[model samples]
Target chain A: MQALNQILRRIPVWAVYLLGAIPAPWLFYQGLTGSLGVDPIEALEHRYGELALQLLIVVLAISPLRRFLGLNLIKFRRALGVLTFVYVSLHLLVWLILDVQVPSQIWADILKRPYISVGMAGFVLLLPLAVTSNNLSVRQLGPRWRSLQRLVYPAAVLGGLHYVMQAKGFQIEPLVYLSVIVGLLLLRVPFPSLLNRFRQVDSA
Target chain B: GVGLAGMARGAAAQEALEPNSWEEITSYNNYYEFGTRKEDPAKYAHTLVTEPWSVKIDGLVDKPGEYDFQDIMSEMTVEERIYRFRCVEAWSMVIPWNGFELADLLNMAGVQDGAKYVAFETAYRPDEMPGVQYPVLDWPYREGLRLDEAMHPLTIMATGIYDRPIPNQNGAPLRLVVPWKYGFKSIKSIVRVTVTDVEPPTSWNVAGPREYGFYSNVNPNVDHPRWSQATERPIGGGLFAKRIPTLMFNGYEQEVAGLYEGMDLAKNY
Candidate 1:
């Protein structure tokens, strides 16, 4: 575990960015070579959406990992966040350009479909976070930046809900993902005070 | 009665427009009774007991009884037909089906004068089909057709595909195959057939009336509210292959269009 931490510490943020960017071209190659099953467009769209969700989960885990395990991955969090936004954008683009080609129909879907509306809501919340990810915006916004970035919590919840609602029937995989997200959110609750209360009760 | 040799000759003679691979046809299915995934039925449907199967022919039929599957097969003459099977979800496949016309079966059952519709019920075996445990849909999936639609020459009671007995996943023993309507209208693994005067309630229409109408004829002009039906992806076509434009009545307009004469298809849809 110590050696693993040392290796993680030595890895540069740029390396994380490069690794994250690799899937994009690999997916494109899969598309070109007809390796993405019968419905390629749908496959590509699903892959991007899943990748984005997975990255968001990783981002949510970073803080808990740092606090409980002393694994500080703070430096790469920004890169991970940026990669999540990229994948989410690509997912949306695939739906827009490939799946639903009609402009009017696209607007109708965003307005009418509950899943699409929630997914769009998540994307909208992430937009400002993507824009203000730089050091300049952090310095300018000062203390308010942290409060604004707290929108990630709700955005992640919406993303999970979107996945659950889109399925035709009860599916366990999406439910598992939503449960994990909920668990991560629950872990964020301040638990040190509860631990102290338990310690006091034991002593008394 | 047509012999098995004649049936084989008929199957060999029919021209298939776009023959789907046997692997593709057998592997992918939408048998929600087994499960929702396209591949689930292929994995789970083998548990379904097909032998000793019987279909209850009741309601307005003169001869109402549980007819044995083997007896039904023995009485009828089988032939082959190549048809386009289009799904409501905008995907399609061309399959060569082997069976007899449903008209012959209905005639043999002696449809009473009052019968206006033919209702079908799929087998509800929870032990065999795990999906039946969930309320994904009302149990014992049901579908219906107007008496005329049921009697149409294109409508067949398919027992096999690709000149072989259809696997359980693809509705073994017996199933209805309505060539023009969306594939869901072709009820699978049927256990009952009722000829009734009233228009029967269909499973999908009952689940969501606004989304799935009683008449699910394939018309590209009428979009499915959630997705456009203008084009369809053919199963087994390479991932990057361009979607082909969907045809009206799935290219059977000439054969089935007259059945809907003087009716507003858009409203009925």
Candidate 2:
């Protein structure tokens, strides 16, 4: 764990950005080269979507880890969140531009498929969060900034639901990520201070 | 894996294998994977290993026997049958399946007169197949048909696909492939095929008896509980504009639809 942390610390933030950016180009190049074997666009979409979800899970884990484990890699959270948004945006763009060429059909698919509906909700909610990730926007928004960032929780749930629906035969891996986000949220909720006696005993 | 080599041997026994593009293969999946998702089979099937298999033929057969994987292959001729596979979920795939007639196998086994139905079961291993581990589906995948459906000329005891011994991803070793019905009717990785007098409850039908029926014939009119029954997306096409008009009995209505002339297909489905 220490080695991983040290390695992560050494890598420049741009390197993280570039690392996140690589899969898109690599998959696109595979598509261009016809290495995806068949239905390159759909394959590309699946790859991008999966990677985007993974990045989203990683981003959601940041604050929870800091609070529980006292690991303050706080500087990377905003960048990681933005990276997730970038991957998700690419995923949506690939679907819109390549998979469904017609605007009406894309609209129809989003409206018709319940899974797509939740996924679109996540995408739409992520837009404002991504836009506000910058320091200037955060400064402009001020007090409302924290509230705007709260959208991530719902966005995470929606994103997880999209994956759950996509899975066949009740895969629980996606649900675990959803649970982690829910657990983190639960940790923040105020409780009756029965812990005072326990803490006092510990200190004594 | 040993199965991969077995497949190579099987391919060598036949003519050059028909190597399908991933689009053609992935889109055209046997519907047992995710209820009715086109890509679900390929995705969930990563958990399946199609090697070290056998088929037990029991109950009301004159020559009741357990056929090992190797011997089952030596018995039949693998002919290419390119049929249109229509799913109840409103998707279709033109699969170039390579398998011989189930009739030949049954005749070899000498099925008795009292055998009224043929029940098929998949190998139920939750540890190996994560799909089985989940409560989303009932354990031990199952499907059944009236003895006549089993005897239908279109019914094939498929051991291979694309002129090759079936890939682990595509119900390898031994499986039933009934072209006329919805793809789920073709049970994958079959371990047992029992001849019985009573109509057996199939997996999906038992899961949602009202929605999925015993006779899940490919009827365009009988809509599933969730989706339209009228059309299907041909594998290899994009989400939009690629769905084609689903044929009645998957274009085998003339051959098999007569088997269910008066029965309410909607009720049975």
TM-score of each: 0.82, 0.76
- The top-ranked prediction according to DockQ is 1
Assess the local accuracy of residue B6 in candidate 2 as a C-alpha lDDT between 0 and 100.
43
Q: Find the candidate with the highest TM-score and give its number.
A: 1
Best by lDDT: 1
lDDT of each: 0.87, 0.73
- The digit string of per-residue lDDT tens for model 2 on A1-204 reads 566667768778887788888888888888777666345666777778888888877777777777777565666887788888988888899878775555665786787777788899999999899988888998999999999998988888888788776554555676776676567667666665767877888999
Q: Candidate 2, residues B1-269: lDDT per residue as tens digits?
A: 23323433443322332344545675446444433344566676666666667789888899887888778778886776656666665556667778877877887788898889989988886666655545666768899989999987778877666667776556777778888788878888888888899998798788777667888888788766444566665655433335556777777776677799898777767
TM-score of 1: 0.82
Model 2: residues with Cα > 4 Å off, grouped in runs? A1-12, A37-42, A93-113, A192-194, A200-204, B1-54, B60-63, B67-78, B86-93, B107-115, B124-139, B162-164, B167-169, B205-213, B218-245, B262-267
Per candidate, native contacts kept equal 0.29, 0.19
Error of 2 at A143 (Å): 0.5
Q: Write out the backbone clash pairs for model 2.
A: B90-B232, B160-B166, B213-B269
